[model samples]
Target: MDERTRADVERAEAALVEHYPRLVRLTYLVLPPSTGRHRRVLTAHGLVQRALPRARLRRPDGGLPAQRGPAAEPGYDVVRLRALRLALAYEGRPLWGPAALPQVWGLRLFPRVGGAEELALDQALSAVPAPVRAALGLWHLEGLDEDAARSVLARAGVEEPDAAQRAAAQLDRETETGAAALLNSAEFDPCTVQTRPTDLLRRRQRVRAALALVAVLAVGGAAAGLLSGDGDRTGRPPTTAEQALDPGRLLRTPNEAWTDTSRVDFTAWPVRGRQAGDRELLGRALRVWAAPPADARIMTSAGTSTRPPDHPPQLLYAGQIDAVTVVVFYDGERLVRYAEPEGATPTLHFARVDDADLTSGAALVIGRGNGWMRYLLAPWVSDVGVRDLLAPAGPVHGLHVTPDAVTDRIPVPPEGGTGCGHWPAAQFRPSTRIAGTGVNPPFLLTDLNDLVPVHLTSVPPGGAPAARAGEATGTPALQGWARTACSLGTLRGAGVRSVDNWAFAGQRLPEDSGSATWVCSRADTWRGPGSVTLHFLPPTTRPAEPGRIAGRARDTAACSSFGAPVVGNVHWRAQSGKWYLLAAGSHGVGGIDATGGVRVSGHTNTLAAPAGRNAPDEVVGRLRSGGTVRALRP
Candidate 1:
């Protein structure tokens, strides 16, 4: 053999050995999932193992070219392209020969089961066409850009490579997850798989009775066909009830139902949009919900189901919100919003609100575009206003609303930054009857990139009674929120239903220093588990200076009513240049204790002990009710 051919062979061999597991994983992700887990595992290993050059280096042909860009290692790229092509070919048609090498018998092999997020992503990827799946695998698993993905697809013999890439991109946008993150999960990793013994006894019995079972099945099939007489010629079952497509059958409440209905939830929201009676619009929306088109973008909040409603849904509102045609529907369990922009693909969003209440169901973000958002208020809403959470004393600007209850566009807050200059929150007052008093208490709602906005409430310091939503508008409450509103960005897309900021403790600093306050913010999501964060707001005159995040915990109920009291500590240096450890807890916390590098205890909910900068310790709060609550980890 020529020296060049020998070198090519050696390079290919080296690459195959070094990146075997990664290449196998890539092929497994690219292959169609219909092959089942056992066969997919074996096939992926077989394809990747045979990816190296055979004996000689033939001229690079029209086959998949070496990938460029980030994964531009010549040898690795060559083998990856070969393995990818083989997987795609296998997806087009079943392998004709005997089972590939690395086969196992009498055992079922499959990857470990992943969490809900991974399962959802797997199902989504499996729904797309094989070529599109390959494109996604390239873009995410291989970390390639659109251009690079298109090039790889074209070289791999995809007829419409650009279309495949576009479809993959559309799916990525709809799923709202980084494909790489899901692909790296154990659900797709075939190398480390779980094994289960096959039903060997059942298999043997099946083998013996195969012919007899087939004969009986053939006779039964003939009898059933003769009796059925052309059942469902379309070959696809109906996704929704018969009346779901009939727009006239949609349930609608009267415009003034809220005044008399005992139920104060969305059940009383009157259908009051300009296009509420547009059958064509309503029919299209229902059809998309039943079976979304290939090009439509669909989004579902975590834990929200994507199934169509079993019965005709209630029509809450159907009208133009901003520049898009919007349709809102409510089944008993889920809230679905459909938005279509002019000359653009439509989007369908679903959020679970089965537990929505008077305060949580007050407002919904109906439209968002070009850095602005619009809200659809409930029938009980009497007035709408906008407040800048950052400027506690700023005037609450009045927002104009159409006759149909759709508010004008309000600018969205910037996503993330240290300098939270402005954060806009919607403030609306419910009818006095709904409030059950002479005063129409105003409620606060902020858009967190979900169909329903999150309710914002606050509690004053010094164990004062927890106030209603209106009291959160007070200067002290607003200032406290201003110091922590930016932190709310972390809760975006987390299916959060409401957030409560409780200023649970106030402590005097040693050496005549100014006081400090400890606020525990708990975000409760629609799905059960929520998050808790503790903030340390030092005495500051500048409102823009945000507080420090002292501690945080996930899936915790601390700081919420009836939950464990939250405790946290931070080492602070007073203006006098002396450092000390300060700890505090929620109301009912009988005492505080610090362990590890520093040991200290207090008879009250607050504790102060001198310590150095590097003092490491764990703090626990002892409840007056004979229980202990640990501080959240930083």
Candidate 2:
């Protein structure tokens, strides 16, 4: 072509190359590693390779075919948006299966996290709703601003700029709280040029199977791999940190994040093989239950040092599943649960050791579920050293043992749900993206830990559901609210009432339905103690209406001693016909006067802090005899 065209192409290619890594990561966020029905289509590396050519070449080159109506060279936002659209359109669905929801909504929910586990990029994205996922993929992962993110979502079929704005705001909250670390840590490995995706799939499977086989054999009896394997040979033996490779280093200890043990009901648990050394039994467990390749290593070691010498050592089963390195924990022949560390390397703690203790390695693994630390330790390893390395150096917590457990492996239901209800959203396909291709309402943002259902018997004009009599019931429901209260500091000294603290909670309210139940725990607002629940009904798009807001605050411990109950009415401001929840203390923390002015008390107990614009429809407010009021959002 002409020299000018050639120059434009060159500049475009350079920009593409410079942004290639981010592009790959973005594409991966839109489509992540999975073994579900969409596996063949959601080829992240492949999609990026294909979409790179369509990005606005240069600031001066104008838009590509997918991007028209743009004047000068479309910015990187346009390019990234195009790439996302391309990825979503792949294989006709981002994910597949009867349950797969558009925008990856069909997966298990990832509610608010409380610092126990470190989620990988894919895992984190899997927890987010699809629209929010897309918005975040643009904002955080792709580095787009709110306006640009709104534009990108618009192009990708999200009609409401306000919704995109809400998603962007939520992302900001997540990043501020370190919730987005997993997405930040996610990386996209370069894909070699290939003609077909099947080839890549076959190669990937074969490699995983081979490694798994080796790992199984090594854990079973062979120690050759550990001694000769490539690791830091800088003459110094590797410390726990040094030995922890990617995935492992990135992984939190069993006690860290949400472990599989968190969701299980031990009463009905199923058992696996009887003893530890039963190669056939262990192998079968690995193959079917652990879902590892036949050859992955299996090193069964008896517990020592930190535990009763006679107690069975925890069996460390290391292998590859779906190209990911994972270590499964077992009690005797029973498969308790499994963990996936990030990389391909074997964990030093779980690595197969040579020489003595072969008998212990083959002995039946046992545990009282006192705590995983003691059971997980290797024979020769020092308990103190490893514990100090794995956890923040401090007083050791006793092993969290499961007692009187009847069965072995947790049962996997028809939907592939391991008795543990929590599944990686990526792995579990749900349905299509919510409010498809339209200006859908923003999803209600409640505590990820809150499981209280918004009873749907009735809803007002803004998509918020009315609370039912039994909206908050069940162990999980209480645990959800308790965790949320704990996070918000309402239960500062009260702590979560139960161990099942967090899980995904939130709702996609219907368009035209206004009003929802919001609970502002004293902890969330840092306003003394206890929590208040209220029905938040913002003014309708048509006209402003005076609505009475009411709620109750309970379970408040220490803060209950605060003098005089705080009082306030919920209020909203109308802008462009859309109502926004006026956060408590926003109007200068005062009681609203006849002229609609607010008055603040020197020491008021408002249940909520001021919620910003784009706040959820429902919010909780506390009012006292003085007519002073404070409100918070769900």
Candidate 1 per-residue lDDT over residues 1-634, each given as its tens digit = 2222444656777888998888888888877787677778888888888777665345444544433334324777778878888888876567434425677754557776554457667888778777898888888778899888888888777899889888888887766346777788887998988664454335445654778668645654543332222223467553346456667778998877777766778888889788988988998788677655545776777667767667878998888766789999998778999999999988999988886877788878888887888888887888889998998888889999888888999888888955667889988888886634456568788888888988888888765422332346777889899999999887777788889888888988888888888988888888788778899888899875788888998777677654667888898898888888889887878999998778989999888898887888889999999989887776
Q: CA lDDT, every prediction?
A: 0.78, 0.32
TM-score between model 2 and native: 0.34
Q: How many backbone clashes does candidate 1 have?
A: 0
Residue 15, model 2, lDDT: 60
Candidate 2: where is the Cα deviation over 4 Å?
1-4, 31-42, 52-71, 74-82, 91-136, 139-279, 283-597, 600-633
Q: What local lDDT score does residue 621 receive in model 2, on the 0 to 100 scale?
A: 28
The local lDDT score (0 to 100) that residue 263 gets in candidate 1 is 76
Pull out the clashing pairs in model 1.
Answer: none
Which candidate has the highest lDDT of all? 1
lDDT of 2 by residue, 157-249 (tens): 665666756864665565422444545541222222111112222333455477665754555322222222223455666443223221222
Of candidate 1, the 10-residue stretch with the lowest lDDT total is: 223-232
- Please list the residue runs of candidate 1 whose C-alpha ends up more than 4 Å from where it truly belongs after superposition: 1-240, 433-438, 464-471
